[model samples]
Target: MDLADDALRDRARRAGIAPDWTDVTGQARSVAPETLERLLALIGADEPAASVPPLVTGMVRQAIPLPSEAGTGAAVLVLESGERAEITVHPGDDGRCWVPPIDRPGYHRLQLHDREITLAVAPPRCFSLDEVARGGRMWGLAAQIYGLRRPGDGGIGDSRGIAELARAAGRAGADALALSPTHALFTAEPERFGPYSPSSRLFLNPLQADPAALFGQGRVAAAIRTAGVAEAMRRCEAAVLIDWPEAAQAKLALFRALFDGFDAAAEAGGGLAEDFAGFVRAGGALLQDHARFEALQAARLAADPADRDWRRWPAALRDPAGATVAAFAAAQDREIRFHLFLQWLADRAFAAAQAEARSAGLRIGLIADLAVGMDATGSHAWSRPSDVLGGASIGSPPDAFNADGQNWTLAAISPRAMVETGFAPFLDTLRATLRHAGGIRIDHVMGLARLWLVPDGMAPTEGAYLTYPAEDLLRLVALESHRHRA
Candidate 1:
């Protein structure tokens, strides 16, 4: 190979793009040079400079090594509890300066010179199943969220059904109820109903939100009747196979009617309205991004049915923070608020379900299943495109289950972006899953270490495995799991 070719391979290797991989058939194959180049460009791989990283992670009570340059700087350790300590970075036996062990397992800030870095101190391991069940063995059941049924679910399973199941399962002595992915999906394209291919892992499927839980059942029934979905909902419940597009439409119409009532209530001022305001406040920018994306996608689809994908929208609208998007949001303020209401209802319903399970004497309550990746055209990619691989899809090589191979058409998180952003995207996704659950079952858990990435529009056989910062990710997961006691 030429020197330039050699350098390219070196850069690819440093970026964690595997030069070769073994297939499911136990055959070794090498990634093509062009394939490597494409993957590398998608990630925009740039090695971090010689400095303290955006974030540092280590176990509690374990001394952490600091960069040699950090030795000369004044280090101030700010604990999460508002306490502060001035510490010295002394060299260890290996001749590297190490910060003193932190006693707490929490995210603390370390100020060194002009740079402030986050210290993510994790527990040694995750909360074990033994701690959850407190017995020799534990048993639980798993269900698809959409397949769950309850009276007047609007032709699809809703969080109210989950609450009902949780109560029944707890009464039956089940310790946990595992759920399928509840991640948000495309509101404009209801036919795309795969739960695993979500719009954003940081948000819930608003379609599954059951307003009946918040609004009294009587009020919800009135809304459903007024929305004229009562007949369709009954048919959906009786159908052998779900009519996703129809059911989703019915559910959304019902939600809109409920949202109208909610807005009216909010204007009058009450505790529930304040609670919703608090939810919106806590949601911060992330929540606004998701809600805005939902509203914008719907608006785009209205103008042209084929314009649902944000990437194909006007360039100005493609950027979440662009002027066009801001103007669109301003013009459609009520539409955006309607989407926000959906999320608010979903959040409250899920939280209530978990609470009911726990109150019914189930120890673990719920184990939320987290999807492996997000849809390429979804909210996460639209709001923070750099945080994910743009021109790649997550998939697997030829395996026993599928001889032709499989292309999930899902976006993988960009490893470089994770480091540059201090793993904020990863942490947000994890925290979202753990928000109202006792535990989380990470789909394709192997993706934590590495993922098989297929170039967009390329055959899965042409894909290569991309390595991740597994150690750091696992540490974060353990820390979160311990915090949630899951």
Candidate 2:
């Protein structure tokens, strides 16, 4: 190779960008220089010639490297349990430090010289299955939550339907009911419907909520008639496949009417008013952001049917915490409250399903599916833009299945950002999925180690593999798993 090629390859190697890779056919292939440059740009590795070693940020069972300033001195180690200890940092070659065994498993802090670093001490393995199985074979029933059919469902299967299914499964000696992702989808753009491609993994899909569960059958029926969607509902229910647009439209109209009645009842001091108030209070900022996004998207769509993506909206309204967004929330207060109310009902319904399964003697009641990532233009990315990588798409490399490879068009979380944010986004997602379920099935679980990322407008085969902080992510998962007993 020429000098220029050698320099480029060396730079790629330093940035963790593989210059060449072995294909599935056992043939060695070199990555094109153009591909490398584009991929490097997406990751913000502009100074490719800079030789920098990976920084050690956390510690588990293995020892981590330390800076030169961290001399051979006793460092103050603070455990997650508020216990502090002075541990001697033994210096080694290449500016590395040996961290002694931390008996506890938690996020701890280490003080060395003038620097303080967060050290995560994780257990060797996750919660063992034997603990819950007790040497017995457990059986589970996995079903598509949306495909479930039931009377008075108004076309779309919902949490109430899942609850009935759970009861039936429990009676049949099933220990678990695994359901597809219930992640929140785009409320404004119902045409872009796919359970796997959700707007946010941190919230539930309001469409899966049973209006009748909270509003009562009579009230739901009255709302259906009031909204002039009874005929549309009948057509949707009788259809074989889910006509998402039609069903979503009908449901939204009914929900608006139901919300009107609910608001009036709550105004008269109904008991549910206080319950909903507490739910909103508990949801806090995260819930408020989601509700605002929904309302804003709807308002934008109404103004111009072509404007659906938030990225295309006015600049000031794009930021979730900006002054414009806050003002919009205030102006569209009623609309935002309607979205929040739907989420409240959905949460209540899913919680009821899990309760039903457990009360029926099932050890593992509900197993919820957690999609790998969310659409880049969706709420999760908009709300936590820093945590997500821009100008890249999650995809798969060329293989026997598809010679050209496949791009899922999903935005993945940035590994570096996750570390910087102390994995708050990941932790929040895990906690939410575990809230109303006994276990969570992580979609594309292999993404924990590495993700195949393709630069925008590029062929999937030209994509590069991006490494993730696998050990750290797994440790967090295990921690949450133990906390939820999943």
Q: TM-score for all predictions?
A: 0.96, 0.89
Q: What's the lDDT for all of these models?
A: 0.87, 0.82
Cα error, residue 16 of model 1, in Å, equals: 1.0
Number of the top TM-score candidate: 1
Angstrom error of the Cα, residue 291, model 2: value is: 1.8
Q: Which stretches of candidate 1 lie over 4 Å from their true place?
A: 1-4, 46-50, 69-73, 91-96
lDDT of 1 by residue, 326-432 (tens): 99899999998988888899899889888887897778888999999999899999999989888989998889998877899999898777877889999999999
User: Candidate 2 residues 310-370, lDDT tens each?
Assistant: 8888889889999999998999899899999989988988888888889976788999999
Off by over 4 Å in 2: 46-94, 98-100, 108-118, 212-222, 265-271
Query: What CA root-mean-square deviation does each model show from the true structure?
Result: 1.8, 3.3
Q: What's model 2's overall lDDT?
A: 0.82
